[model samples]
Target: MYRIIGIIVTLLFIMSILLAALALLVSRISLNRHVWLAGFFAGILDFFYMPLKYFFYKFSDPRILDKWMVSLKNISNRNSFKKADRRMIIAPHCMRHMECPASSKRTGIQCVSCGKCIFSRLREDASKYGYDLYIVTGSSFVKHVIKEKSYDAALLIACDYELNKVMMGLKGKRLITYGVPMLNDGCFNTEVEYEKVIETLELFSN
Candidate 1:
């Protein structure tokens, strides 16, 4: 019985490794093409994320894993997000100017349109596209933002790691998410391609 159990455990471990490898491959492919069974693969990646992150940490940049996962999730969530009627944009505070005059609140930073950063134009475009923009200082504030309002979908803008983190965090909350990764990663002075944000907004406009 002990020998039999050992064999079964070994087989299961091998199977998990194989599935994780396949999921990683598909996530990479998702960057350039549409992938079938993307949700399934994404689930496998999520399940094995810690182990994968460790592997990447030893041999490569773990941020690449986050980037690939975000791409795969975007493909999986695109149609559902497009169908959502009440959508909101959750942008990171890092994208703001070094001297941003916005006031931070429990929900997020309130953009005053001081014209010192992209938020001024982004705020206008978000209004024009019918998305309520919330510039958050961190992921913890998302709970407050959600509590203060109701939304069927969330459009996220942040670093790849934060995008994937929020996307995973919002899973099973009945809110579909789509992420637009920032141009770079940092606590301050980060940026995103304004055109990409506009493109995503138009793509899912109702």
Candidate 2:
């Protein structure tokens, strides 16, 4: 398990660095002059990157990917999604922000497992629902998962700023998103809330 996880992490790291470099290159070449065009191009990159990265994910687990992909397709095509039950919560564990302040200005790194924040609670909810909940980063990766697997929907907890970016990338997916606070002035503890997440899902579930 450790070896598999290690390999996955290493591959993901490489992919992130390469993609970040490409984005930086785009910024440098345009010199940030064509702001609107650069933004559009970035969106294109995100949408296109979804399928490409999904290939890697599927290769990691062919059977799981194959079954989930078909399920996801049906969910995406649904009009009401009333039959959906299981869902995954995508929250930023400690990767979304640089520092904290409200709870003590402790960055996500300070999470001490007191089980008070959104992390533990949401994880519990996910387990309760039999959902594969993960506190992960990367809207790109989320998009990949959406494309490759069938989930009832996602409860994505991201900062307001990244919310737009993530929405842009995930525009057509069938997720019911709940935008939460990030950065300073938020709980400042990097903790997310299960009740709030449930509230978001309830909006579409009923």
Highest lDDT scorer: 1
Q: How do the residues 2-82 of candidate 2 rate in per-residue lDDT, one tens digit apiece?
A: 999999999988887677546535534443233334444444445444553466476663323222222232233233344
Local accuracy of candidate 1 as per-residue lDDT tens digits, 51-155:
999999999999999999999999999999999988899999989899988788899999999999999999999999888999999999998888778899999
The Cα error of candidate 2 at residue 67, in Å, is 35
Backbone atom clashes (below 3 Å) for every candidate: 0, 4
Clashing residue pairs in candidate 2 are: 72-150, 100-105, 101-105, 118-192
TM-scores of the models, in the order given: 0.98, 0.41
Candidate 2 all-Cα RMSD: 16.0
Deviation from native of the Cα of residue 31 in model 1, angstroms: 0.3
Best by TM-score: 1
lDDT of each: 0.94, 0.48
Worst 10 residues of 1 by lDDT: 141-150
